[model samples]
Target: MKNKIGILALLLLSQVCFSQLLTRKLIHGQVVNDSINVENVVVFNANSKTGTVTSSQGFFSINVRENDTLVFSGLQFKSKKYVYSDIKGIDLKIKLEIFTHQLSEVVVSNKNNIKPIQGSQSIVDKKYFDDEKSSSKNRTMMQVGGVENPMDFVRMYKDVFKILKKKYPKKTDFTTQTDFTEIVMKKIGYSFFTNKLKLNDDAIKLFLVYCENESKARMFSKSTTEFELMDFLIVKNMEFKKITAINK
Candidate 1:
């Protein structure tokens, strides 16, 4: 009877241990904000002493257990703390307020404005048309109405080209593939791909790369609204699932 009781006690202890292990799983979370860039925000788990920085899309995953405290801090945002109660779902959405700096009042004065010296005589140097003529002779062919000559016409065109180049320079797109992907992911969230679209992490990444191949995806970076981008993603996601045969 004592051996039987000991075996039952061991089983109960193992069950509790297993439950604790299940509670200590990786929790997916996001630092959500409309006005600020949520990337690089630090999320510190006080209990475990482990932390993770938010992605460009403001998403982060951290190992959390029951009753663990998560602290979120960033340069631009106010620090916030959240306790893991398991009351909320596995996915945590933390909204942080922007930190505003209070500035002291500044005063400007023009009280000591400079005044011209009293009774100062102004001197002027007189110049004749000879100086103007000498200066005119040093002027370039384009400035001297020499455009009628073929060589002068070439010089004139070169000058015009330089001006045009300065006025309207070629625009270079510094936006990289990673940057574009982040922008799309930020506008449309990770949950959209994971939950609604039923895409696994690897499949979601591949689907994004597939979408990036589309010409319309580049346009989504610019003036396209979130709704428009979501619509585009939905269509592409269907095509992606069809091609990859990813039912989930």
Candidate 2:
């Protein structure tokens, strides 16, 4: 009886040590919409060796091995990736972003001669950030434009283009943020256009990726890991620049 009790105590101690040991990590992040917390967004481990979804409170806890890569995915949102070393615990906030999808037609129209729109482009300004200011995790300022909702911007741009076409009634090449600014600037003799912008697969693909990153960052921020990501655009890089000036 004494031997059995001693063995049981050792087993219990071993279990406690295993749970407390940080051999693996618990990955977590909150999924919120507008200001309200959204629950039950699916989160999967990207490494494929292990994976799990979030809980009802927009939080998820997944056990990850050392050096494992984590991938968080959801509906109508971009998927985000992170490393095991980057996530500390299961307390973090994630903000999801939406994508825009528009189809332009190529047909003969007597009213106006608008060219067919082809290809998708994304312009990411190569930003140089200034000195960092110390702030709380929740107090950090997020650009309302990028974080608020991108779908609205897409609609507003589309409407403006429609108005411009109606007013000019010409086949002027329609250019906006939809095209690479570097390509446009190269034609216009501006070298600052060397900023990083690439033709993403499509708007949905881009938005999904953005949302995933944003959400992952939110959760990753709560972790003890340190990140070397670029600073927010609004901090020091927020400014309106022309993508292209259409010709009549």
Candidate 3:
């Protein structure tokens, strides 16, 4: 009987521990403007793991365990984060505070001085350009490893521009784009497995999401413009740009 009692206590303790274990989720809530809900607001945990976006009804949810912190954000509203303990259940009524970022003196100066470089418009990296052409590195990257110039690189960029221009006609400006004429180039590094690349899809997706959000903010938002998207792809590929010195 004593052994049976001990076993029961142990089982009960195990159940209690299980119940207390931390879990993550999507917490749902709404942002109302004149009694109408807004959608696509971001809600994420401090660790950036648990996250979700508001629906058309202005409701969002992210799963989180006890003591986790959640951030609520959107393009027009100031971001706010709160601890799980501060709110109970998924339903929440949040009042968004309007935010207008005042540029610091340094920022103002930099903005004025830093003319938009052609490639700086988007986050295009070399890999994205390569992947668009089936992940084959061409002259700039392949040439360094004693490999033949892969023509696919040019094809990839060409195809990317073609598609982007069709998708976003007004914003795309591939005509003024500079072709990467090979100077002295070298491989900074190589990866046998694509996942080994630090700035992979996971990182890029976040940028894409940000771009989407930024586009919706105003009558004319720049983030998701064709020029920007293509630029992002180019910038992403440039990570793999073989070190090259042009004899200009």
What TM-score goes with each of the models? 0.38, 0.30, 0.38
Off by over 4 Å in 1: 1-10, 17-23, 103-248
Residue-level lDDT tens digits of model 3 in 32-114? 56543566566655654435556667765555666886766665565676777535776667777766577666533635445
lDDT (C-alpha) at residue 137 in model 3: 45
Worst 10 residues of 3 by lDDT: 179-188
lDDT leader: 1
Q: What is candidate 3's CA lDDT for residue 15?
A: 91
- Top candidate (TM-score): 1
Q: Write the per-residue lDDT of candidate 2 for residues 1-248, one digit (tens) a residue.
A: 99999999999999988776546666555665664445434554555444444455666666666567766555555456666554454565666654447669665668665544454222231234544565423437655535532355765787799999899995544333223322222332222212332222342232233333433333323222221222321111121111000000
Candidate 1: residue 74 lDDT (0-100): 65
- TM-score winner between 2 and 3, please give it: 3
Model 3 has a clash total of 29
Clashes of each: 0, 2, 29
Residue 242 miss distance in model 3 (angstroms): 30
